[model samples]
Target: MSDTSKPWNSPMPEPQFDLMRRILSAPSPVGLEGAMTYGVLKPHFESFAPAEWKLQQFMGHAGVVLDTHPGRDDLFKVMIIGHADKIRMQVRSIGDDGKIWINTDAFLPNVLIGHEVTLFSEDPGAQGSYRRIDGGTVEALGAIHFSDPAQRSGEKGIKKEQIYLDLQIHGENKKQQVENLGVRPGDSIIFNRPIRHGFSPDTFYGAYLDNGLGCFVTAEVARLIAEAGGTEQVRVLFTIASYEEIGRFGSRVMAGEMRPDAIIAVDVNHDYVAAPGIGDRRMQPLEMGKGFTMSVGAIASEQLNRIIETTARVQDIPMQRDIVGPDTGTDGMAGVLAAVDCVATSIGFPIRNMHTISETGYTKDVLAAIHAITHTVQALDALPDPHREFRDNHPRLDQAGALEHQGSEKPETADK
Candidate 1:
């Protein structure tokens, strides 16, 4: 889109997924969850990531902030924002009477009680509830209370009180700004943290990388396709899902919304470098620099697996196969259940100490995951309708259907 010489035909050197694996696998320090999240979210949020160049063609504009890191100064700062008016009903502590109290003075750490703290909520109906209070006074009898000991005891405890912000603009001038920009009170607020490329160029860390890396990969694929003049009949939806760590809620919602012909749920998998329970025997042993792992189990359809496997073989991409046994416990579950004709697959990086601050992955796995996913998508796009039909009628399906049709089928068979 920028008139740069497109390397659509020229064989671009396959990224060394091994390098990504090594970098991500490095022992991260404590309190670096933000680094992980930032790693994942940065590509989606900034134009500096390689994928931004391609996304510009499809989205018309890259949905990324250009000036992500402004100052060279370093200071450890953390800002927490309440979600909409839910802060209004903020519950600080359990009261002696077993009731929750509202603490009007319970302002966020650095901001003052009456200060305008940015509030963000995903709910559309609750976005406009911001209101400023005089020194942030809470109703003494209200369900929220402050943590200050002086305010507690008589009727309510300051520790039991919580403060809520009313973000609604009351003045006419403020109303005009809202009308022009479409900013409203339940509108979700996002705080921007300067993207800090660590002091060492070889090492960097920040927030939001959990599934952000997957989002980045998708963006890069989109860019590659756009630069190749785009594909015919296939549309890719690069989604930045919410609530993945909490409960795969974003994937569920995305699956329900798109009901795509097929789905590939990309996320991180554990790399047992330092951990004991995981090894090469039971769980597919993944090295930090090996590449991406593809899951094999009931959750992944044979057809999709074959397609992915074949593509990787042809492209000479390094990949590992993981057997998940009965279930994968991934967003792939939600994707499979969303539509009758859809198939779901998993592509994951090797992360160590998952769900912890020290969670690590190799840079190689990241690059490998990107290659694996792009190849899978291309393979799927190239398949004809008849191929899909044949897969549905394959012997494996017939045998399974026959077992179901015949009441003589056994419930379970133990491994010999």
Candidate 2:
């Protein structure tokens, strides 16, 4: 397209890399999300939310849902899916010498031996409940520097069991000091890597891009939709599904809660991460700067994919199609099983080094994804009978001839 044409199509504000960085820096490690991350992310959700949009937190789960579905007889529901959690370790025990023994649900790379980290604990500061308290620099045993350097063995292949943290205060009365301050087992520990400026200004290097970027993008989609006074035809819902890393807890908890017409999900994928099999941008299936990865799976709605593909072209956003999964290793599958027979599909964002402190994402591609989702949401309003294509091809019954879809039909949208 010519330079003049580009300006006309690009109407949205520059994607907020800052917002993505903010969430990325905050720690929302798996099951510990409510204790560490929910409060951190709540402010952002409140700030960007429009008056018509209703933001609600699910205590049973560790994430938030922003509802924009209108109160009407005929309503189309679209869920923009993303997880709001990351990988981290926990304090299993506090040694008498002021050392903290850690345990993790996820496999953290041994390369973390020499990295700095933050310890999150609870304190009832004036408030009636346990508030977040900084526990200071996490001192790992095998780190680069030790007080007596020559005494070190230059260890290799460190395991989580062998690791320990230095709480600084030690010797007699050590356990008492830590215990009195509410430093107990089960507190979360996360790497101390702040969101840093990447190779270029537009690029970002931070923790939790796997879904921090996903969460940010989901919120951005909601913000864009809400700004336009919500979609006329489809009542759009941008959901930050939590605990996706460890078998999708958020998706399961909230699944079938609302029987939407279709479900759409996105997460930073491994397709474009710096890898050998993926090479040459032109030949790559899904690479950075190539746009979003449109995954085609059995559970994914074919009609939704068609609509996304059409919207991508119209918006001049490049999209790569992947034919892989009976279960796409994403929230889409969980959503599929949960909601009787809602159409399920996903978009994969390109990023490097998932499950690391310094995951990398291209700003241009991230912004492009936001546009693609925004355009698809916009198209839902303009498209007539968007659900027909998927419905016609949808499964009618099982081998035993029982109806595939049997549940509470939509009484009305949330607003009603």
Best by lDDT: 2
lDDT of 1 by residue, 337-385 (tens): 5543466677776665443323455554666666666666665556565
Best by TM-score: 2
Listed per model in order, the count of residue pairs whose N, CA or C atoms clash below 3 Å is 65, 2
Error of 1 at 350 (Å): 0.4
Candidate 1 C-alpha error for residue 279, in Å:
5.5
Query: For model 2, what is the alpha-carbon lDDT of residue 390?
Result: 60
The C-alpha TM-scores of every prediction are 0.51, 0.80
